[model samples]
Target: MPDESATLALGAALWPQLPVTGCVYLSGDLGAGKTTLVRGLLRAAGHDGAVRSPTYTLIEPYELVGRQVFHLDLYRLGDPEELEFIGLRELLGQGLLLVEWPAQGRGVLPAPDWTIDLAADGQGRQATLAIQ
Candidate 1:
């Protein structure tokens, strides 16, 4: 669905079922609302902190409703092997992870519990969710 409401609704519906030890991969073009949907999820989880793409920092951590959530941006990742330095395993031990630009770490990253693809259309976005 390209509508913001529908995208947010889908995220809300899946909120309660999120596993404490799983990852969600977001695939989308620039300005496709990937961060927006993440913001929606964080808000649904009772988080009030500002949400921004971790493009430069590579990762951002948040505490939401007692859960440790990690948001990762692999855009700047020079090599998939570099993920090792970030302590991938240690981060995965956290409650949940939402990753953007996951292709950068294709083989190294864990199998995602859910994958979301988003595309820009006019002023809104089209979002698709798949479970793996």
Candidate 2:
């Protein structure tokens, strides 16, 4: 998109079409706006509070708009096996799962239903979505 607002709008537009239960892997380098996109998606789902990256915690769970949503940032993960320690297995299929740095959790994380890859493009970002 052309700007952060555009990126957020793309996410807002996606809210209705997104399945309530599925995995979405967000791929991108640092400062690529992955969390910003997720923030927009959640806002469309009626979340009025802050939407911050769960970089340190690894997972941020949101019980919103009548469903569960979990955002995970695995950049700090030392190993894929660490996901099990965070109860990822139990969270699977329970709600919408948005994962960042999924490459870090390759073996432990389930295959995503959707993948969003973001990259810098001029002053904005280029986001590509893939269904798998």
Candidate 3:
């Protein structure tokens, strides 16, 4: 991807390939377009509300059509066990999860069905997707 728009398009394109219920781990540095990609996915999934990284809140829930989506940002997490207090298992069973800073939730969070890594490249960003 060479720009934010490209990143968004990539996300939209990926939606149809995603399972109705599964986890997606997004690995990227700060400002690497992780949230932008997520915004695009949400829009493609029919979400029209504000979409922002749950940096401070940890997780943000969205209801789109018949699906439930949870965007989780673990950047500020001090411990992976904190995921239990936030109903991680329940969310995994009930909706699609997009996690940023997934390494923070290592042992507590379920393995992701897909992993997307983004990195700054020149004036834009590059993304690579890996299916697990």
* Colliding pairs, model 3: none
> Candidate 3 on 1-132: residue-level lDDT in tens?
778899889989999899899999999999999999999999899888899999999999998899999999999999999999988888867989999999999999899999999999887898889999
Q: What is the lDDT of residue 83 in candidate 3?
A: 96
What are the Cα lDDT values of the candidates?
Answer: 0.84, 0.93, 0.93
- Model 1: residues >4 Å from true position, as ranges? 1-9
Task: Give the per-residue lDDT of model 1 (tens digit) for 43-96.
Answer: 778888798999998889998766888989998899998888988878977779
lDDT of 1 at 21: 66
Q: Could you give the candidate ranking by lDDT, starting with the highest?
A: 3, 2, 1
Per-residue lDDT over 42-129 for candidate 2, one digit per residue giving the tens place of the 0 to 100 score: 9999999999999999999999967999999999999999999999999998999999999999988989989999999876899999
- Over 4 Å off in model 3, which ranges? none
Per-candidate clashes come to: 1, 0, 0
TM agreement with the true structure for every prediction: 0.89, 0.97, 0.97
